[model samples]
Target: MSDLVIGLGGLAMMFALMVFRMPVGMAMLAAGYFGTVLISGARSANALLVTETFSAASNYSLTVIPLFILMGNIASVAGFSSRLYEAAFAWVGFLRGGLASASIIGCAAFAAVSGSSVATAVTIGKVALPEMKRFRYSDALATGAIAAGGTLGFLIPPSTGFVLYAILTEESIGQLFMAGILPGLLLTALFMAAVALVTLKDPEAGPRGEWVSISMRMRALMRALPLVTVIIVSIGGIYLGVFTPVEAAGIGAGLVILMAIGMRKLDWRMLQQAVSDTVGTTAMLYLIVIGASVLNPFLALTHVPAMLGEAMTSAGLGPYGVLLLIIIAYLVLGMFMDGLAMLVVTIPIFFPIITGLGFDPIWFGVVAVIVIEMGMITPPVGLNVFVVKSVAQDVPMATIFRGVIPFWVAMAVCLLAVIVFPQIALTIPSAMFR
Candidate 1:
């Protein structure tokens, strides 16, 4: 059989394995190894596996993953996320739908430290949900805001999505990190606007929260100053060329650790738990990276990306047309697959097509992450929706889905804006790094 046929069969088998509840990394590894052995000899496949494993294990650039994960875990244990939520509430909680907006803002702030969407959702949801409930906020609006806001974790600087995308496409992680900043803030604004629109339609859904005095707001801000300082230092340091991405990660983690200790928040037990959590998350990420490394070579052998590129070019769909199709495909995949799994499964195939059409890889990385974020709230397997649901148990799954609808539309708008004016994603990176 032809290599293309073999490749297609391998993908089908991998999907079937995933359907049967197999881990995505293992399924990809199984398919990749089998396909490679079929196309090349078993000896070559064995050699590739050994080399890839070593490469993934020892890749210095990957240190950013663990350091950033450690920073987030420590911040969580230190109660920094709650401080962030309180600061946001002090500023915005008085307005109509302000509590929900505070949740979004708090999520964005926490996301600057923690790159995981579920972490952002769970952390902020825990702090903000009860307050919104006390204010008699509608379940849909309150839950939707948290679920949608959680997605900011994927697009903001220090994002694992961007880091993984950079590794896969061989783009500069710094540039991708820079590229995400403006777009991330833009999405945050759009999400807040969506909340406003929802509340405007039904003011009773989100009654106005109690306004705090200026002194209270100042105190809240001061309490959150450490977290804000860490974000500016780490992410801002990267843009200023003061530190590389890995260096920034190390500094960020160190700063958070110091802050936690100074606040008496870090005990031996808490420190141990944070380290353990970091190791587990890091291991899972490395496994996916290794699986992708194996699968990429197997796909290259099949020439599937080349074939698909040729087919798309021949089909007379211009660059944007082809991009639209790919975006739609991601949206569909997001409904069923985990976001990281979608990235691992699709990037090997789609990255080539994207770059082949002369699109900017960095900009495409931002776009891909936004689409993945959309999937995080998409129905069926919208991971963030389930995450928020877990925290807000009284709110039905259906209500959370309904709540995210407007925010999802807001994401669509942001996507269109970035596509039309690529500068939204590229301008900062260019000005800063060029």
Candidate 2:
């Protein structure tokens, strides 16, 4: 058997393992290892596994993952997420569908601290869903807004999506983070527009919230300042070149811990929980990185990415056509696979193809993230939708999925805008680095 056939078999086995409920990291590791043994010897596979595991675990840049996760966990335990929603509510809750809009704004704000989409959805959903229900907002719009908005956690600065992409592609983390900013904001705005259109069509779906006094709004904003300040200082420090991404993460985590303690919110138990959660999440991410590292070598030996690239380029599809096809594949794969798993699996194959077509890697990172974000709210395997359902248990799964439709459409628009005008993702990064 040919090395290419072995590689294809390995890919199939990995997906089959995933489908059978095996953890994605393990599945990839198993596939990569056994596949290597098929081509090389057991000694070579063993050596590859040991070396890659150490390399992935000891990589200095990966420290950013835990620090940022710790910062987010500390913020959540300290009730900063609730305060964020309160502040957003004060500012926008009076407009039609304002509560839903506030949820989106709050998610965007919380996403600055939390890089995980599931965490963002759960954190904001717990705070906003009850209030929207009290205000008689439609279940569909309320839940959908939270589900869709949570994806910002991956697209905003301080994003794990960008971090993983950087690790895989060896791009500048700062540039990818900067590239995400305008697109994140643009998507947020588009989501808000979706809410407006929904409320406009049926005022009864989203009733107008009572206006807040200016003083009250100011107070709420002040109460939410800790997280906002942390986001500005940590993320802003990177853009200003005052801190590397790792330094920014460390400072962000430390500042959040101090702020929580200052507010008397981080008791010993709460602190333990935050640390425990961060460790668990960090370990999982490390495993995935290791798996990808091991698998990449095996795939390289098979020359699969090279073969795929040649086939794609020779198929007479122009760059845009290939891009569109890639996006469609992502959409379908996303419906069945976890976002991070999909990223690690596909980037190795597709990155070469995309860059070979002369597209900017930084811009492609943003575009890829946005498309993955859409999958988070897509049907059947929509991770964020399930997260929302978990929060609003009484709301049917169908209802939550139904609600995300408009926001999903908004995300498509954002994706297209970024595609047509690459500067949407490039401008901030360019100006910053220049």
**Candidate 1 regions with alpha-carbon error over 4 angstroms:** none
List the RMSD of every prediction in angstroms: 0.9, 0.7
Please, what are the lDDT tens digits per residue for candidate 1 over residues 1-434? 99999998888988998899998888888889999999998999999999988997788888999999999999998999999999999999999999999999999999999988888999999999999999999999999999999999999988999888988888999999999999999999999999999999999989999989999999999999999999999999999999999999999999999999998999999999999999998998998898888988998999888898888877898999999999999999999999999998899899888888999999999999999999999999999999999999988999999999999999999999999999999999999977
Cα displacement (angstroms), candidate 2, residue 217, comes to: 0.4
lDDT of each: 0.93, 0.95
Instruction: Report the C-alpha lDDT of model 2 over 8-45, residue by residue, as the tens digit.
Output: 99999999999999988899999999999999989999
lDDT of 1: 0.93
In angstroms, give how far residue 420 of model 1 lies from its true place: 0.7
Cα error, candidate 1, residue 267 (Å): 1.1
Task: State TM-scores per candidate.
Answer: 0.99, 0.99
Candidate 2, pairs of clashing residues: none
Candidate 1, 335: how far from true, in Å? 1.0
